[model samples]
Target: MAAPVCLEYRIEGNDFMVAGAASNNIKNTLKMLGISSSVCTRVAIIAYEAEINLVIHGGGGVLKAEITEDRVKLTAEDEGPGIADIEKAMTEGFSTATEYAREMGFGAGMGLPNIKKNSDEFNIESEVGKGTRLYSTVFFNKQ
Candidate 1:
């Protein structure tokens, strides 16, 4: 069995240029670790969507990836304005992205929904003035 692997990324506010950087890194790492390509693709999508949320909504945050023999776990912690309504935020096509973010072809309100769709486990917590933290896991064994 291989030792567990972990990776961290710092996401900047409104940084569209590097929004997908962390996700790309994780994808490459998974490839190097011999994770199945199908699993890698799912993780990539989950990581990218979460990273974008941190960039467009969270102001700034840290994204972490933990890889083990059984599963891959992802967490996003941000220091921006937290989500006001968890239920509302989860709804598709509901976004509070800035005009600039919209101009970047992001902020389509698909980030969180996509994240939830791809992860085997998903949880999110947010405080209006504090911050938001997201937890998601993708298992290597499908059945």
Candidate 2:
């Protein structure tokens, strides 16, 4: 595609039923545009994890995907109780997910790690009371 394509979704906190919708939509968009399967899978994982983070931790937020010829950028922004320690939050198996969320099989503490793993570039900024924002990029040509 010559022009960039942008997709955005509003994710609600504790909304289990609609948690995966935004990620799926982003993946489908990549596929429809003939993006490579590997890239699509990576982007899908990033999007899904970010979406879940929004629902389980962010107290609702916005998830966005920007597709360009060379890369896809994903952003998850939330005005929820933000992370106090980004480093700890990024640790695998460390989570603040509610008991209800755990019962629903939603929180395993892998969200940030997984997103980072699949992203060509990843960044996160959060404030204790303000909110959190995550940026992840997946390159289309990375083999």
- Candidate 2 lDDT tens digits, 41-80: 9999999999999999999999999998899999999999
Model 1: lDDT equals 0.90
Q: Which candidate tops TM-score?
A: 2
Candidate 1 lDDT score at position 24: 98
Q: Against the true structure, candidate 2 has what lDDT?
A: 0.93
- TM-score, cand. 2: 0.97
Return the lDDT, model 1, position 137.
Answer: 98
Which residue pairs show backbone clashes in model 2?
A: none
Q: What would the per-residue lDDT of candidate 1 be over residues 3-66, giving only the tens digit for each residue? A: 8899999899888887799989999999988889999999999999998888888897999999
Local error of candidate 2 at residue 32 (angstroms): 0.4
lDDT over C-alpha atoms for residue 101 of model 1:
80
| Candidate 2 residue runs with Cα over 4 Å from true position | none
The lowest-lDDT stretch of 10 consecutive residues in candidate 2 is: 134-143
